[model samples]
Structures are given as C-alpha cells and as structure tokens.
Target: MEHSIFVMCILAVLSIALANPIFQDFSQLKAVENANKVLQLVDQEVLSNHKLGQQSSLPQKIDWREKGYVTNVKDQGQCASCWAFASAATMEGQLFNKTNNLITLSEQNLLDCAKSYNDKGCAGGWMSHAFKYIRDNGIEADGTYPYTATKQECSFNEANSVGTLQNYVKLTKTTEEEILKAVANHGPVGVYVYMSSLFMGYKSGIFEDDSCTETPNHAVTVVGYVNTPQDQYWIIKNSFSKSWGEDGYMRMKMNKNVCGITYRLYYPIV
Candidate 1:
C-alpha cells in the first residue's frame, strides 16, 4: 500500500520529467533512425495517458532484493566495463523472471568474448551490443568465469553456460514515464546516462546534476523508483561496490535526467 503510493508520486514526477530536451520528440533525436525502432512490449492503449488514468493508478515500486531475489552488489574495479556489469545484472533479472532462479552471470565472459561483437572489454562498450552477444552466444555463470575487473582471453565454455537470453527489446519511446512503466511491468533494465564528476563522490542524497551533459557515457541498471512528495528518484544499482552511494545504489531525482537516465532503455527477453 505504501509502495503503491510511493510509485504513484514518482511517476507523477517523471511525467513532468518527460519534457527534458533529452526526451524530446523523435525528429529532434540525433539517433532518430534508431529511435524509430521501438519494440511494442507494452500496449499503447493501456498507456494512452502518461500522467493520469487507470494505467497511472498502478505505480510500480519494485525492489527485487526485497522480494526474496538476491543480486549481489558487484564491483567493476578500475575498469571501464560498467556496460558489462549492467548487462549482466539485467540478464540475471530476466533469468529470474523466466524460471524463478536468480543466478549471477559473468561480466568477465562479456569483457573477453564479446570483442568480436564490437565490445572493447574494459575499454568500454554498449549495453545493446552486450545484449546482442548474450542472445547470440549464451553467457557463462559467474562461478564458472568470475570477474577479473580487466579484459582477458576468451575462455568461455558452453558447458558453463547459465541462463539463456532470447533477445533484447528497446523501448518504443524514450521518456521517464515510459521508463517507469517498463520497470513496473518488466524487471530491471539497462540504461545509458552521462556520469558527471559530481556523481563520482555521491554519498546519500537525491542526485540532480544541472551540469550534466546531454550525451550518455556510462551504463547502469535501474532497479526501482520511489517518491514521497518531496523525494522522487530512481534507484540505480551501479557496479561501484557496496562502499559507493547508498550501499552500491544511487538515488537519482526523477524530474531531472542528471545522468541522461532516459536516453537508452532496454531489457532482456529471456
């Protein structure tokens, strides 16, 4: 009951946030060609109204960890492989959704093997490409491959493969409201956001960086959202270890895309 109310308020905040230049109309998007490729995973009729209506009544306030699902806080450690960690986390969530088994997958497998798929290992990568790699060649279990926090030779064995990824879906529309809908209906999702220096030392607070750039430079998973009139934000599960932010999670304000949180939104189809 409390969670329902919390999400209702956050979605209210995000609805206003949809007007950010980053979430502008399709024609203005630099990636307009790609923006045209929106998958219809959610029914448009059910969500015709973004701010108010029956659809708006069901606010999603999800926290997989609070519901018996356990996803350990992983540390990428000195590596620019945040994309791998984000992808791994999304895949883990989708795996749990399909079979009710939440097994941690390997970020190292992607760091090494996905090079052929255009991933630069620790140098950097895109979550969309990482999802493609998982769809084509299944990922290895963390127990089998383990994270080295650095790029290494591809020693991925099919015998150690954990969950299967069917494909990945991009949001039909990029809006904070749409992001909320996805997280509420679907599980956790991978997002692209520009991380400013201000976020480097984020401790405890609702992050809203006015100096944040429009371009996205980092990848992370959005686990949930919450609001209490004054506090409305997205709970991001980063790969910066438990020592960072609120126990490895950062609360970014909803009405502002400080980190370009609504730029690239995608979830795995397990």
Candidate 2:
C-alpha cells in the first residue's frame, strides 16, 4: 500500500510537470530546488485585508516608470531576498511620487535590520515586516548601506536613512480591480504570488499559466497595467536582474488573479 501511494505521488508530480510547457526543465531556473524555500518566506498574517479608501477613478492603463516614480530593476542574486527587494522598491516608488526624487533605498538595510522582526534576511521574509521595520527604524539609502545579496550583521544607521514609511496598507486579496486602482492612484505596490516553474522560465509575452498555483510565495512589485483589445496584463517588476524576463519585468494576465498576484498586495505611504 505504501509503495502504491509513493507511485501515485510521483505520478502527480510528473503530471503537473508535463502540464507546464514554459519551464519543462527545472534546471533552467537558477535556484529551482530552492524556489519553495524562497516562496515560503511570506508571513500569512500580513495577507489580511485592511480598510483603505477606494479610488473614484483610475486610468485604464498606468505605468509608474513612465510617470517617473519607479526605480531600476534590482537583482537579489542567489539569495532569497525578494521580500527585501520588493519592500525597498515600493518604498522608493512612494518616496519618488511624493518628493519627485528618484532615490534608491537600501534593500540590504531590510535584509539585515528587519531580521530582528521575524525576517530571515536572504532566507525569506514578509514585506509587511520590512515595512514595519522601516516605519519604526527607517531604512537607509542604497549608497549608504548597499546590497550584498547575503545576510549580514545589522548595521542600520538612522542618520543615513533617505526614506521612511508613514504607514502601509494591505489590499483585499484576489481583488485585482481594487489593486489596479490603488496602483494607479498611489505608486507601485508590493505583491506576493505563487512562483511556478513556468514563472521561473518566463521570458516575454503575457504570462497566463493555467498550471500555476494560487498559493502566495514570492514577493514582487506591481508597477502598472495595460489593457489591450484582446487581453489585459499587469506590469510586474521582478528582482531577478535586468537579464531575466522582459528586462526584469513580467506581463502577467490581469483580473484572473494569475499566480495570486493580487493576493497580499501592499504599498508604503512615504
């Protein structure tokens, strides 16, 4: 009976693997085996809904980069630092939208300092925790703290902080329209999504993997959205360097909650 159960499990894994054509070979991903380890970093409590005012009107299409509020793509390297990257990116967008200055905040600051508040640095972390750390202690500038792509001893200097969050809000899960309105009115928002094998191999085009899981894992930033005649997609900024995806950006199918992109959305108010 045990042997039969083991065979069934293997078959289940194989079936799912065959269903995904985008990433047939898991080896193509840099840290394929560690993908789950990376994704499991998000704190579930942060996924709760928070009361936020609804936007009266939002543009059909909005791009934070074109509006001059987003920073460049960052690389987390071999480390599972998506939480830190997303946090810093969202904060940078908030600061830019408010002050009109594109200042690069320090992901390393969160990777190190935030570990005290249930953050695991490179191993994994929640963006909510990172936001809380920034709100309480403030985050330093990238130039001041710099990113090492690995966990290090906390060396946060409040004196070098160039950005700080007044507060953050957790958007309603699976509410893509609400998330769209938030991103359009505010700046870029930090979001958590299930990183499928196909997502790891995504190169270009609108990503709509039917085989992808809905469980949230990896942290990313939603910068904007574009609506076309045939399809609508969200412009997501990833922390996998400029070489990955469409120059470190992925166009995910909008309104379907693709990979749970709307699941645990958050943005900082600078």
Off by over 4 Å in 2: 1-53
Candidate with maximal lDDT = 2
Residue pairs clashing, model 1: none
Which candidate has the highest TM-score of all? 2
Looking at model 2, how many pairs of residues clash?
Answer: 0
lDDT by residue (tens digit), candidate 2, 139-251: 89899999998788999887888878777887646498778777877779889887666787789999998776635667899999987667699999998888889999999
lDDT of each: 0.71, 0.77
lDDT (10s digit) by residue, model 1, range 150-175: 78999989877886676677753388
Which ten contiguous residues of candidate 1 have the minimum total lDDT?
33-42
Model 1 misses residue 187 by how many Å?
A: 1.1
Report lDDT (Cα) of residue 234, candidate 1: 89
Q: Estimate each model's TM-score.
A: 0.77, 0.83
